[model samples]
Target: MAVVFENDLDRDGRKRATASLMSQFQHAAGLCTIIGSFTFLFALVIGLIR
Candidate 1:
């Protein structure tokens, strides 16, 4: 019983860590996508003006 309880706790900790890491990565990817799109639009506008 004690071993099972410890295993459960360890599993929970690992799951929480994985969730947080995934969220951080998702946030960074979103920021990069937004920046990339903005830059693309800016370049397009400049090209049209010229």
Candidate 2:
């Protein structure tokens, strides 16, 4: 979905599209970091209980 939307830019539109894609990428990266941190924390707690 993101890739499809990103590929439709005209010359002027290309700059906007690039910025939008960067914003999207940053958002996805942040979410992954948060999810990963919590996952590791939970796994550590589970291991300690065993």
Candidate 3:
């Protein structure tokens, strides 16, 4: 109970932080691409119907 705050400036933590950030960025990018494709397809279908 004496050591509640671990050191935050460690090598492993920094490496993990960067890796996590990169993966999260990629995830968001992929989601955006999927949504964009879906929206485009919906618009295309609607246009064709009209």
Candidate 4:
């Protein structure tokens, strides 16, 4: 148990942390892209209708 904990504390934990960071970054980027696209489309429609 201690060995497993130590391994996680050293290398494995770092990998997990990096993976989580990357996943969060991707999620944020996706959200931004979706929101930006929607806003752009909405503005375009509003402009055209006006």
Badly placed stretches (over 4 Å) of model 3 are 1-15
Residues 5-46, candidate 2, lDDT per residue (tens digit)? 445557775547667678788878888999999999999999
Instruction: Put down candidate 3 lDDT per residue, 3-36, tens digits, no spaces.
Output: 2222344555554565556666777788899999
Q: List candidate 2 segments past 4 Å from native.
A: 1-15
Q: In candidate 4, what are the lDDT values of residues 1-50, reduced to their tens digit?
A: 01122222344545466555666677778889999999999999999999
What lDDT score belongs to each candidate, Candidate 1 first? 0.66, 0.76, 0.69, 0.67
Order of models, best lDDT first? 2, 3, 4, 1
TM-score of 3: 0.68
lDDT of 4: 0.67
TM-score, cand. 2: 0.70
Q: Which segments of model 1 are wrong by more than 4 Å?
A: 1-15
- TM-score winner among the candidates? 2
> Which pairs in model 3 have colliding backbones?
none
Shift in Å, residue 31, candidate 1: 0.5
Better by lDDT, candidate 3 or 1: 3
Candidate 1 whole-model C-alpha lDDT, 0 to 1:
0.66
Worst 10 residues of 2 by lDDT: 1-10
Summarize candidate 1's per-residue lDDT along 1-50 as a digit string, tens digits. Answer: 01111222254455455555666677778889999999999999999999
